[model samples]
Target: MQAGAGQTPARRSRRRSPVPFLIAWIVIIMMGTAGAWLYSEHMKQQITAQIEAQTARQIAAMENNYEQRIKELDAGYSSQIAKLQSEVDSLNELLTFTKDNASNKTDNSNKLYTQLSQVQKQLDELKRKLDMLK
Candidate 1:
């Protein structure tokens, strides 16, 4: 060993034991692995939350579409009901007119028969027209 400035030749310094260093290195590596695992877990949670939010939005949109379709169907039914009611009212009026004329029949039974036959023919024609509409 070489002497430093006017000092006697120095003995070699003792080498540090490797056992403590190895233990420290193992501890550091374990800590790094644990940190990585925790970070991955946190990221997984975030991804799950995002997917759930997207699904909820999709479900809400589908529900809104269903409600809109129901409204359209209800409107169509209401229109059909109104048309049918009008047709029924028209038939009622025709029946009332026929009844009023029949009540004013003359004393001769032949005239009454003729008037009844004509009303029956008119009703048959109206029914045929209604059937065609259907």
Candidate 2:
């Protein structure tokens, strides 16, 4: 057969339907979007958990610092109070000693006054005797 005469000319190639390719593309795009959304959600959860853990650690550190500061303040106050009490006790002892000395001085002054009066009366009677004889 002549190469092109006995055969019916090859029918023009049938056009392939575009619908299956379009459907395949749509499915691929949907899967890619879902994958991206899932990845974003996972990253958000990880970030949130890290932030929470960091905040908890900072709060615990602050609390410990505060407690240590309070302890130091308490120790300082207790030391000051003890020092003040010691001073008060010393002053009280000094006051007691001064009071005892003041009372003793009062008693000695009274005795000296009584002796001076008796001596003065005796001298006056001696002068009267001498005048009568003259």
Candidate 3:
């Protein structure tokens, strides 16, 4: 006998089951997946908001540009109309003066009448164009 060997061991080393460790790992992975999904959703929402804001700004800019263009066109048309009316009035005064003088020259009267008719036709055409613009 070697110096009082133990008759029996009080306890033995035991192997632990792997099931708890496996369960813990699975839980951690699931939590990570959920977090990733939430982050992706948040990013998507932010992107959508930015896009909508940009679109709204573009639309507002376009509307403003069109309004400015329309205003410019209106001013131009007004000046043109006033100029045409003045020309017509001046022509009328000239015709009246010529008639009152009555030189009795048939050729000159005929030429003046033809020019007046042509001017009238041009005025009519301009009126039609103005109406179309309106």
Candidate 4:
């Protein structure tokens, strides 16, 4: 190498400081961490909402089944009660009919007994008069 006429020895190029590189690396790490955290939070929110929606659907289905069962039970009970009521009404009618028939029979028997007593008295009086004549 030859030295120039007006210039001294060539100066070495200045090296870049490591401080700016370190700062840039730190900023990149921070941004990556923040982005990851945001993504994780968003995923958590989505999962929570999905679970809540599924729970709501299950609850609604259970309620519908319960209501249907209740309606079926009510219908069965109503039918059974109606049958019992009909049976009770029929028994009452039978009891009334039997009572009226017994009353009629009792009245007829009393009249027959009174007629037999009158006939017996008349026969006894005839027998006494025939004995006195003899």
Candidate 5:
């Protein structure tokens, strides 16, 4: 095309360089990566919280079971103690009865001795009469 008489030649439009486009694309990708990383971290925190809650529940259940077992054991121990006390009382009574019986035997021994002495004297007299008759 011929230039107009007073007008300068038409200048070509400046083409955009690739560097700015590349920089914009890189910024977009960086923003996307950062967003993805943030989402991943948030999900990890949620999972950790859920696990902690489950662990706490399990620990509470274990504590309850342990407490119940301890209570049962204490009840058994108390009953055993009561039974042992009763047995000890019964043994004490038996020991007291034997002690009283021993004292009664001592009083009866003197009478038994006197009866034996009189029986020996009568046996001697009978022996002399038998000899004279022969």
Candidate 6:
């Protein structure tokens, strides 16, 4: 009985405190939380960068498509204007010739003059449209 009492006192003096282990665990948990927060922020930045890059690419493609369509329409308008101009010129020449030579053909000369006026009006309208487009 006296020997057991002495062994109990020695064991109590050699025992470790739970306070140091609790502090170590707390430090470890804090470090893990901080690391997770930093990783989350880094991932968010990367995702933002990727989204912005995709948007820029989409914008560029749209701009290119619009530019090409504009060029094609411009070419179509140019050809139409050239053809109309040539028609007006030819009609003018024919109308002048008819006026000078057709002394007894009043009906034919009047028809030719009306047609020339109509063609000239159309040419002027087309020119106005082309200028507005520019």
Task: Please tell me which predicted candidate would have the highest TM-score against the true structure.
Answer: 6
Cα deviation of 6 in candidate 4 (Å)?
21
> Looking at model 1, how many pairs of residues clash?
0
Expressed as tens digits, the lDDT of each residue in 41-126 for candidate 2 is 99999999999999999999999998787677666655655555555455555545655677667555455445544544554554
lDDT of 1 by residue, 3-62 (tens): 777666555567999999999999999999999999999999999999999999999999
CA lDDT scores, all candidates in order: 0.70, 0.67, 0.78, 0.68, 0.67, 0.84
Model 6: lDDT of residue 19? 98
Residue by residue across 45-78, what tens digits does model 3's lDDT show? 9999999999999999999998787677767766
- Which regions of candidate 1 fall more than 4 Å away from where they truly are? 1-18, 92-134
Models ranked on TM-score: 6, 5, 3, 4, 2, 1
Q: Could you tally the backbone clashes for each prediction?
A: 0, 0, 0, 0, 0, 0
Per-residue lDDT of 14-124 in model 6, one digit per residue for the tens?
Answer: 578999999999999999999999999999999999999999999999999988887887788788878878887888888778878977888987887888788778878
On TM-score, who's better, 2 or 5? 5
Q: Report the alpha-carbon TM-score of model 6 versus the true structure.
A: 0.64
- Model 6 clash tally, residue pairs: 0
lDDT of 4: 0.68
Which portions of model 4 show Cα errors greater than 4 Å? 1-16, 95-134
**Candidate 2: worst 10 consecutive residues by lDDT?**
125-134
Model 3: CA > 4 A from native? 1-14, 92-134
RMSD score of candidate 5 (Å): 25.5
> Deviation in angstroms for 63 in model 4?
1.3
On the 0 to 100 scale, the lDDT of residue 9 in model 6 is 44
**What TM-score, to 2 decimals, does candidate 4 have?**
0.56
Ranking by lDDT: 6, 3, 1, 4, 2, 5
